[model samples]
Target: MSDATRPRLKVLAAMSGGVDSAVAAARAAEAGHDVTGVHLALSANPKSFRTGARGCCTVEDSHDARRAADVIGIPFYVWDLAERFRRDVVEDFVAEYAAGRTPNPCLRCNEKIKFAALLDKALALGFDAVCTGHYAQVVTRPDGSRELHRAADMAKDQSYVLGVLDDRQLAHAMFPLGDTETTKEEIRAEAAARGLFVAKKPDSHDICFIADGDTQGFLAKHLGTAEGDIVDEAGAKLGTHSGAYGFTIGQRKGLRLGNPAGDGTPRYVLDISPVENTVTVGPAASLDIHALTAINPRWCGTTPAAPGPYTAQLRAHGSETPVTARLDGGELHVAFDQPVRGVAPGQAVVLYDGTRVVGSATIATTQRSTPGPSGA
Candidate 1:
């Protein structure tokens, strides 16, 4: 939309102290929107400086965001959401692991914190939309309904993590970086041209909350240590582990198994049972899962009433697999055209129709066929 035709909106841009958000906020302002920058203080005790680019939410990041807002000539502020982050993302991560399921903290944060909590507060304050640096597009149909789609930059597409956003959230969401075909280097160049100091900053990686990037160690601290038995499908003990929650599906390394398979092939983590306090290890071929049942469905638009052909993404940043899925009787049933391995409970399974995000749900259970004499 052109500046003359587009309505000037009271935009609340979420500056994450990175080059992308700085550039995104600048773009929103240059588009003639009444933009104000806000950085989320997700950590209560924020670190003074980040260790390389491994994590974010440090005291130095807040300063970068402030300087960017100054260069953009927009008012800036920091919102302390530490308590909410702990209760929603961090605690949920620990609880999911304790229940013997792998969870995606980024997806949870997008669902509960960014869209739910932060968006709610923004709307309550009379903001027209919440703008972010997420590389996902929001398309509005002629019927006045909104849809979320993948970004033009496929390499940086974040639609999988954002699949949890419902129609309501999509209505008030703005992603300034989504429609761009520019590369990351181009984005940094844009930031530099705009006089943003974060132009050359490294993109944050790993779990932002985990400073050391040691997920198992963080979980052990929260869930505590407990010796558990590692067994086979037939309940034959193979080894022992400090905690069953530490291992996830398709995990091979760090298993520390004392015995190898009968055929001498390496074993993979097949299942985790918190109830039994047991971790199941089996052949790698057995990890292939044909079907899955998921709950807590969140759709971008209308809910599908019948089964449809689409693609299923089992993890963020993972490849999509062609599948047949249906939302029936308050649950999602997905049958993969090709069996996918490493799927675990508590992970979000996002469905897509081509580039458009159909919806997402939490994987509750999966059905796997055993490899028989044919080894199929």
Candidate 2:
């Protein structure tokens, strides 16, 4: 947010009943904003989501958030966004897998649900900014343009998932926890000091909608089971599987192949063909990708005018790899300095300039051959 904005602006804090978000709402209220806490009810069947104390996006989580809001002296409300989440994130997840690709539901939630749906409503309700616990900084340049950057705590930085946020979103976004150099331990301590009940709550690591963390089973239930052939790069049938959507690129376990490779080396899933209902397995080296094409580019600040040097992160928790990328013909093309493994279609490719997030796109295709440093 720009410095020119008023100090006591109306701020909507998204409280997920997590320690980080509780602290974030408290911090925002302390900062003198007219902060109001809100918990997003993302599932129609709340019981179908994770229900234990450690679970998120559930009835228990909403209770925790309401109690935290009372302690923070903010009005609390629950917004039922179950239909939107089902359409944008859940359905998209199933369709991506059905199309022989892997999708990150967490990242998609941040994009379609958190920023798009939530932020839009907040703006319509006269809120000056929407605040969250995401560990990413919004830096305002001299020209007053906002840029999204990594947090001081590298280990907990979430800029990769927030890469889907565009420049407009950055303008009205407030991350109370991002600028701090404090670790997770410090944050928890702060929450406890502030009398937040979620201080010691275990962090949720599973997909909120998939309560059991059984992704294969979830996909099978949604996409249905179909007997398919498991094949190799040479079009030779290696085995058969219940469904092609059950597997993921670069998967190395539960292949259930009839026999091991000729060299007795474990093979990895190199490709999935939904049309052919087949999964291709090969040596690990076959999973290395040198370049890829991405679609639906969303820039955090400004779109790059030309190809340039930058670093790319393929997964939310993945390390940044040196890359050269550019946008052309409505697609983002990126070339890695060294081949990286396990990059899959339907996953986002977030580009960064140093600690600042440039933008992100949905990966569509991967190539084993390099496309030159400029991705020409």
Runs in model 2 deviating more than 4 A are 1-6, 51-55, 369-376
Q: What TM-score, to 2 decimals, does candidate 1 have? A: 0.96
Worst 10 residues of 2 by lDDT: 367-376
C-alpha positional error of residue 7 in candidate 1 after TM-score superposition, expressed in Å: 2.7
Where is the poorest 10-residue window by lDDT in model 1?
367-376
Compute each candidate's TM-score over C-alphas.
0.96, 0.96
Report, for every candidate in turn, its global Cα lDDT versus the true structure: 0.88, 0.88
lDDT of 2 by residue, 268-341 (tens): 98888888787888888787789999999999989999999999999989999999998889999999999999
